[model samples]
Target: MLSIEGLRVEVEGKEILKGLDLEVNAGEVHAIMGPNGSGKSTLAHVLAGREGYQISGGKLRYLGLDLQELEIEERAHAGIFLAMQYPVELPGVNNMIFLREALNAIRRARGEPEIDALGFMKQVRDKARELNLDEKLLKRSVNAGFSGGEKKRNEVLQMAMLAPKLAILDETDSGLDIDALRIVADGVNLLRSPERALILVTHYQRLLDYIQPDRVHVLAAGRIVRSGGRELALELEEKGYGWLSEEAAA
Candidate 1:
């Protein structure tokens, strides 16, 4: 579903992702784990078409189309979803309304009819309940006054509703406690399908324990230095990233 090859990216004048390469096919879950400043988030942001990042080199393609050619909204409309590490707050914007509009916008782009208010509400309520999200929060401004765990759940809620082809979650587990993490992971697991792929960018292996990945990649120094199965995550958890970083350097 997504192809990244020798992807080099720069923010301002400094390079971040240096010759990174990854391939995620449909029906696969890939976990990207790394320490601080390893360009894990940079890869996520670049794939999401966030501004301020310059693609200095390499190629990125999604569903066989050139990803760099698509604008941010276009990428979203094309079924690319990025659950950010920090979900922004929009004061005065009703969470329900924002989600409905966003979902309908994507639907319309795909030549599908917009979901009616009743259907949308039902869908929202069902997903909110599944995510253990307070129904009252849906009536409030998006992410406003939401706790860290609530914000992460809100991100998962959005992903569930959008049903994107490729979902990139950037540290959805960062601030979540065990219960919240399980709730969020369960919601993410429910979205898993043969037609949908997920790239989870995380710092620790705890998240992987809930949502088992088809492959675990260790990204250090802006590139994937090792790719292995779930055991790799266990190894990382036991041995930490120091060995991997040293190996990459060597």
Candidate 2:
């Protein structure tokens, strides 16, 4: 559903992605494993159309349209979702209100009718339950006073509610304990389907144990250097990225 070819991105004259190539088809989960500063987050931001990065060279095509032609919200309206590594805390905005507005905004963008208050509440609560989130948490300010795991689950809850065609998760497993990791993974697994695809960017292999990817990619030196199956994550865990860096250079 998403194709990125020869992507070269620069932020303030410094290049982060150099000829990075990746394609995520519908119904497939691809895990991008890389060490620090390997451009994993940069890739996610570029896909989401975040500002400040210039696409010096490349083509980003999503759902058959040139992604460069769409704005950030336009990309969201086009069914691209990014679950951030750090979910922001909104002081006055409740989670329920946040989600309803977001959902309706996308709907309006797509020329669909808005959901009423009652309908919106029910759907959010149901989705929250699906992610095992407490009903009261919905009433609280978005991510305010939430634990790390709760924040991650809330991200999943948003993904579940939005039901995007492509979801890019940038380190959703970061700072979560085992139980929370499993919960987040479970929520992600439930969303897998022939109509959807996921790009999971992570630094470790433990998350892969719960959510097995169809393909594994090693990102280093601003590009996807090597790719393999699920076993690739295991090998990276055993041998580390030093070997892959050598392979990539070779």
lDDT of 1 by residue, 126-164 (tens): 999999999999999999999999999999999999999
What is the C-alpha lDDT profile of model 2 across 180-226, one tens digit per residue? 99989999999999999999999999999999999999999899999
For residue 217, give model 2's deviation from the true position in Å: 0.7
Candidates in order have lDDT scores of 0.96, 0.94
TM-score of each prediction: 0.99, 0.98
Give the number of the best model, judged by lDDT. 1
lDDT of 1 at 100: 96
Task: Mark the regions of model 2 whose C-alpha exceeds 4 Å error after superposition.
Answer: none
Judge candidate 1 at residue 98 and give its lDDT.
97
RMSD of 2: 0.9
RMSD of each: 0.6, 0.9
Locate the minimum summed-lDDT window of 10 residues in model 1. Answer: 1-10
